[model samples]
Target: MQEQANLNRRNFIRISALTGGGLVLGFNYFLTSCSTSQDGGQVIELNAFVKIDTKGRVTIMSPNPEVGQGVKTSLPMLVAEELDVDWKEIKIEQAGLDTVNYKRQVAGGSGSVRESWESFRKVGATARQMLISAAAAAWGVPAAECATENGHVVYKGKKKTYGELVEQAAKLPVPENVAVKPATAFRIIGQRTRNVDNHAIVTGQYKYGIDTKREGMLYATIIRPPAFGMTLESLDDAEAKRSPGVQQVLRFDNKIAVLGRSTWEVMQAAKKVKPQWKEDGTLESTADYTEKLHGILAKKPEDKPRRQDGNIGQAFAKAAKVIELAFDAPFLAHNTMEPMNFFAHVTADGAELYGPIQTPERARGRIAELLKLPEEKISVMMTRMGGGFGRRLMTDFVEEAAMVSRLAGNVPVNVIWSREDDMTGGFYRPMCSYRYKAALNGNNELVAWHHHSAGVSGGGASPDSFPAGAVPNFQVDAHTYKSPVTTAPWRGPTHNYIAFSEQSFLDEIARQAGKDPVALRLELLEQARANPVGKVNYEPDRFAAVIKKAAEIGGWGKSKGENIFQGFAAHFSFASYVAQVAEVEKQADGKLKLKKIYCVVDCGTVVNPSGAETQVEGSIIDGIGHAMYAELTLTNGRPDQSNFHNYRMIRMREAPAVEIHFIQSSVAPTGLGEPCLPPAGAALANAVFAASGVRLLDQPFIKSGLFA
Candidate 1:
C-alpha cells in the first residue's frame, strides 16, 4: 500500500507543486531527531513532522512548543484552513526536528500567528492548487472550472477525491502560479474551532516540556553559584557520588551539575555537593538597582529625541492649566507555569535536544556556539510549552541541558530548573519610572504633553508600541541602566509601564481641567483622527475605532452602581489593536476589587472566536497578575522572591470576568497575544483614581492598598 501510494504521489500534480515549493521552502528534512517508536517496534521521528501519503491524508509540521497558549492547536489550524480539508478528517503531527523546513519554531513575542500566517498558507495552497490542476488535465476540462472542496476536484457535476487523481496529477507540470481562495469565501479561516490538543491536555496525555521519557535517560541538577558572576573554587564530589542512585558529578566553569537516575535523586544528591564559590558582588539589591536607574535618569537629556511635536515649552507657557505626575513600576518575572527544562543527548558528531523553547533558531545558534559543533549537527525540537509569557524565549536552560547531557557520555539527560531557580535565573521585565506633564487650554482641552521615562531602557523589548506620541504637542524619551540580571521581552514591555503613567496623568489633567476622563481621551483621539498631530506612530483610525467600540460595548458614560468607578484605556501592539474598560470598587478598608472588564479589539480578521476570546481572557489574567500581585524583587544581592509562593499569579477566584468583542473587518489578521496587556494596567489605574480619589501610580496595585 505504501509503495503504491508513493508511485501515485509521483504522478500527481500535488506532488509536483508541493515538492517544487518544498525545495524552495529549503526544507532540509534530514535533521528531524529519530528514535524507536513508543511501542519499541519501528523507528519514528517526532510526529510533529507530518507527511501526506497518496491517499491525500494531510500531515502537519508543527515546530513551536505548546504552552497553554494553544500553539499546538492553532498553528495547525492555519495549515488546515488553507488546505480546504475536512476538519474532521485532519490528522495533526508534531513537526520532526527539521530546521530547513521550519524556521521560527520558537513561539515568543506572541509571534507565532504573525510569523507563521503566510508560511502555512503558502504550503497548503500550493498543494491544493497542484491537485486541482492535475484533475483538470485528467478530465480534459478547463482548469478554471475545476474547484477543490474537501480535498477533491469537481466540474460539470462530476467529482473525484484527490486520491483518485494523484497518479495523473503527479505527471502534470507544476504550475508556477496557483490560484488561492478569496478571503470572502473562506470556510475555516474565521470560524471557531476547539483546540486540536484539548483532549490531550485535559486527560494528561499531553506531553509538557518536562514530560519526555528517553531510554537510559539520566536526570541532572546544577548547583549554580549563590550569586551571579561567582566562580566555583572546589567541591567534594565523593559525598554526592556516595548517595544511592547518583550517577556522576560534573564540574564546569562556575558550577557543579549532578546527574542521577531520577529527578528526585539528582536533586537530593545535588544538595550534598556543597561547592565553594567566590562572589563577584555582581548581585544587585533593590537599593542598588533603584539608585543606578535614578542616576541614569538624572543625566543631561541626550538631544537625540525619541519623539517631538509642537514646541512643548511654548505650549506649556500658553496653557491655562498644567499637571505633572511621576509614576513608577517595579521589576517583574514572567513566571510561566512550567519552569525551564530541557532534554538532550549528545553524540560525538551531533546532539538531539527537546524542550519548551520559544526561539528554536536562537537556541540552535546558542547551542552550536557553546558546544562548538556545526549548527546542522544539533537538532532542537520544540515541545508543548507549559507557559512562555516570554521566559522560554531564552535558551539558557536548553544550553545547560545540552552541556550536561554531553558530559554524561551519551545518556539522555533531562535538566530541570526548579521554580526558585527559574524565578531568579531568568531575565525579568525591567523596572521603570515615568514623568509626565500635560497642559490644558481654557476650554478644558489637552494642549501640550511631555513624557520622559527612566530605568532599564526597553531595548529589544517585544511590545514596541510605546513612546506613543499621538498628540500634536508632545515629547518622549527613555533612559536606561546597565544591570547584571538579564531582561527579556515581557508581555507588553514598555507599554505596560508607559500606559500606566500616561493614562494616569491624563486622568489627572482631565480632573484639573474639570472634564471626564473618558471624554477627555475621546477628544484627544478625535484630534488624532481628524488632523492627526505630528508624524506619530499610531493608526489613527484603528485607534479611534477601539475607543468607539469600547464605549459602545461598555456603556462608557453610564454610571456604575454605588461606590464603583470605571476607567478606560486603549493601546496597539503586536501589530493589532486592543482597548479595555475596567470597573472597580474601592472598599472602605482600601482594597481595589476588579468587578468587570470590557475589551474591544480589531485583530484584522478573527480566526477563531473561541480562540481569540481565550487569548483575550488569558491576556487579562496575565496583565492582572502583573498589576495586582506579581513582582520579582532583589534584596541583599539575591532575589527576594523565588517561587509562586513569593511571586504570585492571579488565582481563578481573583480573576475578573472579562468580556471580549472584536470589530468586523476582512483585513489580514494582526495579533491578539500581547495587545490587551498595556490597557489592563492603564484601565486599572484609572479606576483606582476614580473610585478613591487616590491614584495608584504603579503596578502590583494590591501593594498600594487602593482596594483596601
Candidate 2:
C-alpha cells in the first residue's frame, strides 16, 4: 500500500496556469496520473515546488502544519535558500494534508525540519537547475557556466529573471539527481527568518480551527460522561432543544450534543442538558492510585528487564553506602490555548474536516473508518494551531466533529470543546512513579544503579536513558498499571518525568560523594567515553560538550550574591543532547523565583537559528511552568482542576530569562522541539534544591508545601 502511494505521489504534480501568464504548483498525493487535454497529448509535468509568475514573485508551499513552532516559515526557507531567491520575493502557502506527497505532514515529535531538510532543499535545487538549464539553452551557453542568483540565471554578462525562463523550464524534464548547496553556501537556512504568518497572527487575521466558518455551519458542544470509566445511561436534552437558536439535540453512544446557530447559543443550550452516567465504582482517586503504586513497588513485581548488565546484588551487598529514593509525577493536561475543536461537513458522498491536527492522515483514516467511507473520499485540512504539545496527535476530537456533522442531517458542523470540557477530557500524560537505588564503594565511586518505573502501559523512561551504560552494574526494570484515564504522549513523553527523577537523584548521589553535580556528571560521561558498557544511545562527546558549554555560559560555580544559587542538568532525547543551568532565588514571600536559565543544545545542523532558539526558550518556559504549577488531580474519577485559574501556567512575571546556544555541526539535523524540555524540569528542581535546601520528590512543586 505504501509503495503504491509513493508511486502515485511521484506520477503527477498539479500545475494551474495563472490568469496573468504565471504558474501555480500544487500537489495531490492521491493523483495516479497526469491529466491530459481532450486531444490525448502528453501534459507538462511541472513536478517541482518553486513557482514563478510574470511579476517574478515566488510562492512556496509549506507542507507541514504550523503550531507556532515556526515550521511554516522554516520549511519554506529551505526552498528559498536553494532556489537562490531573495527572501522578499517569496510567499508561503500552507499545503493541505497530503500523506503520499508530503510523506509525514504531522507536526509532532519535532521532526519537521529534520525530515524536510534534505527533501525540501532538493525541491528547490531541482527547480533551480531546470531554470538554469532553460536559461543556458536560450543564451546558447553551456549550462555549467550559467549560475543562479537572486531569482535570476546569469551567463557571462547576460541575465534573465527566473520568471522569464519558467515557461521553458516547465517543459524541461526535472533532473533525477540535483546537487543541493553546501552548508557554507546556505543564505537562509541558518539565518534569522521572520515567521511568514506573523502579521496575520498578531493582527488576529489568521484563521485557526476555532475561527473556521462556512455558509450554514452550525455550532455543537458535546456533553461527555462526567467521570472516567463511566457510560452515558440517559440524557434529557428537551431543555437544550428549547433554548434560543438551538437547532437540535443528538445523542451518541457516550455523549449528548447540542447543536445551535452560534457557539454561544450551543454552549448555553448544552449547559441546560443533564446527563446521567453509570460508574462501576472500581475507578480510583489520585490518592488511591498513589497508594496502589507504592504497593506495586513494595511487592517487587516480576522484573520486565529492559536493560541489564553485571549482577547488581553482589555490587550492592559489597557497597559501603546505598542510597534509595522514589519519585512521582501526576497526570498532566495539554491545555492547548485553543481548546479541542474541529469543523466537519459530512455528506452521503464524502466528508471534509478542518482543524489544528498534528496527524491529519491518522485523523482521515479514523474518520474514514468511522464513516465506512473510502479514504480518498475524506479530506482533512490543517489550520495553524494555538498549541499542540502532543495533544493534537489524537483524532478523537476530529472524529467527534465528523460524527456530529453526520447526525446533523449532513449539514456542516463545528464542534467546540469548552475550556472545562478540554480539561476534563481524557488523553492526559500518564501519572507515573520511579524507584531508584545506587551503591557506592568506600572510595565513593559509583558502582551499581538500579531503576524501576511503573506507569500507564505505554509511558515511562527509555531503557537506554543516560548513565545506563556509564555505570559498572546497571539494570532497568519496568512495570505497568492499567487505569481508566486515557493516556497519550505528552511533549517529551516519559523523558519529561524521567529526566527530573534521574538527574535530581544523580545530584543527590553527587552530594553523598561530596562532588560537584556538574563535575560528577562529567566524570560519568568521561567513563562512558573511555570504556562504555552496553550500547550507548547518545554520543558521549556531544553530551559532555553541552554540559561544559552551559556551565561556561551560566558562570557555574561562581558566587551570585546571597540567597541566589544555580543548579545544572543534562539529558539526551529525540536524538538531541541538551544541558541546562538554572539560577534560582527565594522571594521575600517564600515563593521560588527562576531568575535565569542557560541552555546549550547540539541537535546538529541548525535549520533556522532564530526559530531554533525560540523553540528552546518556549520549551524551557513550558517545562518550568509544568514543573512548578501544572497538575491534574482526580477525585471520584473526575479531574479536579477546571481551568487556568487553578491549573496555573508560567505567567509573564514568572518567566525567566533564557539564553540558548546551538553547537555548530555538519551532521544531519535532529529534533529540537522536545529535547530541550526534558532537562528544564530537572534543572529547575536542582536549582530549587540549591536555594531552599528542599528536595522535590514529586512534580508540581506547589504541592510540596516548601514554598508555603
Candidate 3:
C-alpha cells in the first residue's frame, strides 16, 4: 500500500515566463517545524527559488531569516545544487515576508535548512527538467537525451545557455516528477563556500533591523515597568514633551513610549517621563526561586512521571550502592547583539513592518489582528539580524512597535529597545535545577536511575533524554512553578540545562563506580542497542560514534601539559548527536583556564562546512562563557545585571582554541544551530571537576571561585 501511494505521488511545479526575457519557477513548500500563523494554523507557501535573467544570471531567493545560522548562504545551496550551477554563478536574495509566497520563515530550532532540503531540491530539479524538455523540443531529440551541466542544457555535441531556452521552457508543461542529483554529483555543496554576504557584512554595508529608516519615520523608545509584577498608576510626560527633539509621549498598557526625531533624543527624553507604578503580583527574587527548587526535590515526588521503566524500588533494594547528587543552573538572558527593535507604519488603510524578527509570519498575523485589518493589508519584512539566539522568537517588541505606531495618530514609528531595556525585558531562560539518585549493582553497572527536574515558570529540561532506555529501572519526574516571570525557549530549550545536569551527574556516577566515564556511557549505549529497556530518544550507534570520535580526536585519557585536565560529555538534541571534550588548565591560585574544546557532531550531512564549523565554535564559546562567568539574577522582581558592565561575558583573551569534527553521512541534515551548545557546559563542568578536584553542582564557576 505504501509503495502504491509512493508511485501515485506527484509534485505540482508552477513555471512562468518573465515579462521580457527569462523564467520563474515556484512550487509548494511546507515546513515540517509546525510553524504557524498568529491563529496557530499552518499554510502552504509557494517558494520561488529560480529566476533567470537575460544576462544568464540565476537569482535564488532564500525564504528564511538569516540569524547568523548561515541559512541565507546554506539554504540557497540546495537550489544551486540541483540546478547544476557553480556557487559563484548564482545570486542570493533575502525573501521578504509575504505569507502568500513563503511559509514557516521562522529561524528558531534550526529548521530552515533541514525543512527546505528536499522541497528546495525538487524546486531546482523541476526547473532543470522543464529546461531540458524545452531544449529537447527545440533540438528534435528525446528529453532524456538532454542533460544540464553548469547552467547549460547539452545534447550530443550541442549545447545552449539556460538563458536561451528559459523563454521556451516557461511555456512547457510542468513535470510531475523530477530527478535530483545524487550526493556524488554535488559540486556546489560540500565546497567550503564563504557566506554570500561576507563582504557586505565586513564592509559595514549590511543593513540590520536597527538600521531601518523610512520617510516621515519617528524614533521611539519604550519605558516599561521598572520591575516585573508592576502596573502603571500615573504618568507625567509634560517634561518629556518639552525636552529637545521629543515629539510625543504615549502610554500603553503598563509601559510608556517616547517619540522624537532620533533614537538618542528619544532615549534621553524617555528618562524624564516619570510614571507611578504599583505591584500587581508578588515580587519574587532569585534567592526565593533557588531555595524552592532545592527544597522541593527532598521529597522527590513522582506524581507525574514522563517516562518509567522497570521497578525502581526493587532495583534500588538489590543494589550494592546508591549515588545521589544535585545540580543547579542559573537563569540566562538571550542578550542578542542587536537589541529588540522594529519599524512599523500603521495607518487606517494598511500596516508596514520591518525588523530583525525571528518570527516574521507570526508578526504579520499578529499585526493584522491587533489593528483589526485583514492579513493582506499588513506587510512584514525581515532584515538581517545581528544575532537572534532565540531572543527574537517572541513578538512582544514587534507588537510594541505596531501598537505605538497605531496609538500615535497612525504614524510611522521605529521602536527600539536600548541595551538596558533589552536586558531588563522579560522572556529569559527559566532557572533550572536537577536531582538524581542512581543505584549501582556490585559489578559497577547501573541498576536504577531516578531523576527529578524543577524549573521556574515551567520547562527548561527534558525528561526524556539519555539513560532512560539504557537502564533497567529508570524514571523521570518533573515539577514546574508558576511564576509571574516570563520564560521562553533559549537555544536547545529542553537540553540546555538537562544535558549539563544529567551529563555531569552521569560523570559523577561513573567516578563513584570506579569506571571510566566514556567507557560507561558506551556500555549503556551498547545495552540500549542490545538489551531490553524503555523508550530511547537517540540512535545508540550514532550516539556512540560521536563519543568515540571526540575521544579519538581529543585524546581522552591521554597525556597532556602540566596542570591540564580533560572532561568528556555527549548529548542528543534537535535530532543531532554531539560529543565534546573540554581541556582545562589549573592555575596556581586555584583557578581554571580553558585550554581548548574538541567537538564532534553527527548532524547528518553538513550543508556548508565553513558555516557549520562557525556554529559549533560559537556554541562552544557561548556555552563556555556562560558556564565560566555569565549569570543573570533577579532581586525583588528586577534583573540585577542590566548591561555588559554588570553582566560578565567571556573576554577575548580568555577565549579558548576549539577543534571541531563532523561525521560524514548521506542522511538528511538535522539541527546544528543549537545541539552543540548544550554539551559545552556539561563538558566544562566535568573538566572543572577534573582540574580542581571539586564536584561543582552549580553554574557560574567563576562566582564559585574556581575560575578566574
Candidate 4:
C-alpha cells in the first residue's frame, strides 16, 4: 500500500513550445502546478526539463551528479520506460544544479535512485499523457481509445508519430492524475542495458573532474599542514615565486595555493616554498588513539546507552555458556582513482564551478557563501568522477578552487590534490573497536547480546540495527573520544566496519554452541520472524532469501575438496539485503589463498543488470581488499601510509573471483552502492579461520597474523 502511494503521487507538469517548434514539458518540486506565465520575475518557460523536437529527438536533463554509480544510465531508464518511447529515440544529458526544478541532488547514501524513483516516473508519464492527448484530439477520437506504443499513438488501424503531434500537444491543457505503466508492462526497464557512457568511458573520451580544461585556466595545488593539530606559522615563497611557470602563490586559512601554467609545474613549485609549522594542539599517534578507544569500552559510566532491551545482566548470569570477543578496525582513505580536483571561475558577474562532485548543490551553496554572492548567481556543472566512495561528498576541493580563483582576481583555475595530500588530509574512516558478548542457555540457545563500541566518532551502527530485535535481552553502549583528526562518511559508514565485528562475533557464538554458522543465523532469524523483541527494520523473508541463495550457490554445508574452506555472512542496509559465501584454499606451508566469493542481493528491482553486477563486483573487491591489506596509521598525528605503495590496495593477482545473483521482484527499487560491501569482511575473515584456524580480530587481516 505504501509503495502504491509513492507510485501514484500526483505531480504538476507544465507544457510549453520549444524554441523552434515541438513540445517541452517540465515539473516543479511542489505538489500543485502553476501557470505557464511568468512568476517571481522569472520565466520558467513551462518548466520544461524535457524537450522533444519535430525530428522526434527526445532529450532529458538528468539532474543528479554521476559518480560512476551508473546513475547517468539507470535514472534515464526510468524516464524512458514511462515515456513509452523507443529507447534509441531519446538522448540523455547532464543537468546543472537547478534548485527550482530539482530536489535532493546529492549522490551519497546510495540514494540517487531510491529518492528520485517517483519523480523520474512522474516526469515521463506526464509527458506521455500530453502527447497521447494531442494525437487523440487530431484523429477526432476519444483520448481513452488511443494508446501509445513505440513513441506512436495507435487506434484500430491508424497511428501517428509523436513528433507529428508534439506541437499541438504543447497547446493542450496539462494532464492531471497521470498513470504509469505497471512493472509487468515495462519495455525499456528490466532489460540488460549497458551504461550510456560506456563507449566514452572505454574510449577514454569521458571528461573527468581532473581533466577539466578552461580557457586561460591556471593549474593549482595546495600545501596543507604537515599533520593534525598543526598549523602553518609562516611561509617564505621567494624561491617558488621565481619558477618560470609559477603564476602566483596565495595563502588561505591553513593552506597555501601555488598556481602555475600546468599541473606538473605547480606540484613541483609548491614543494620549493619553505614554511614553519606550529602545533595547535597535542599531537597523538595511532597507538594513543587506539588506547583511548579501548579505555572507552573498558569503562565509561558517563556515556549513555545507545539502546537497551530487557535485562542483559540477568540473562548472562543464568547462561551456562558465554562467548565474548573483541574486534578492531583502523582508519581508511577513499583513494579515488582520480585525485581530488575541481575547476572554479569566480568572476564579479557570477561563479562557475565544473568538476566531479557527489553533491553539486552542496558545492554551489558553499561557493555562494565563500564568494558572498546570491544563490542564483552560482552555476555548478558536474563532470564524471573516476571514483568517490563518499570523499566527493565533501566540498573542500570545490571550495579551494573557488577561493583560489577569488584570491587571484577571479582568474579561472583548476585545483588538484596530489595522492599524498588526499590520504593525509584528515577525512578518514575513524578508527574504532567493538566488544561483543553473547549469553547462551544450557540448551545452547542464544538469549542475550551485549555490545560496547568506542570510536574517534560515531561511524558504526546503533544497537537497534540488527540482532537487537531478535534477542530477548540486549544492551548497547557507544562512546566517542575527541581528537584533532577529522572523520566523515565512508562507504556504508555504519555497517562497513561493524559488519565484520558483528557477523564474526556471531560465528564465535556458533563455535561455542557447536552449530553451523548458517544454521545459527537462520535459527535466530526465525526467532525474530516469530516474535520480534523491539523495533524491527527489515523484512525477514527477503533477508532470509539472499542468505539461502548465496549458500546454495556456494554449496554451503556440502562436502568439499581437500584444502577448501568456506565462510558465510549476511547483512541488511540501505533498504537492501545481501549475503556472501567466501572460499579460501589452505596451502601446505600454512598460507591461505582467496579463491572466490558467491554473492546474492535482494535490492528489489534491478534497473540495469550490467550495472548491478558491476556494483556488486566493485563493492566486493573494495571490501575484501580493505579487509585484507588496507590500513592507515598515524605517527605524531601524521598518517604514515601516504599512497598506494604503503597503503597496500588489493592487487589484481590477489583479488578473488565473484559470482552474483539478485532476487527478481516487483517491489519498488532500492540502492546497490553500499549494501553488498558491509558483509564482505566478515565472510572473508570466517573463511580465513576455517582455512588456517586464525581468528582475525583486527583489520588488514594480514596484520592479524593470518600470514604468519
TM-score of each: 0.90, 0.94, 0.95, 0.95
- Candidate 3, after superposition: displacement of residue 335 in Å? 0.7
CA lDDT, every model vs. true structure: 0.71, 0.83, 0.84, 0.84
Q: Model 3: per-residue lDDT, tens digit, 306-346?
A: 77899888999999999999888888888889999999999
Candidate 4: where are CA atoms >4 Å away?
1-20, 28-48, 705-708
Candidate 2, clashing residue pairs? none
Q: Per-residue lDDT of 485-518 in model 1, one digit per residue for the tens?
A: 6787787656666666666777788788888776
> What's model 4's TM-score?
0.95
Residue pairs in clash, model 4: 26-47
Among all windows of 10 consecutive residues in model 1, the one with the lowest summed lDDT is 1-10
Q: Give the candidate order by descending TM-score.
A: 4, 3, 2, 1
Supply the global lDDT for candidate 2.
0.83
Looking at model 2, which ten-residue stretch has the lowest summed lDDT? 34-43
lDDT of 1 at 622: 76
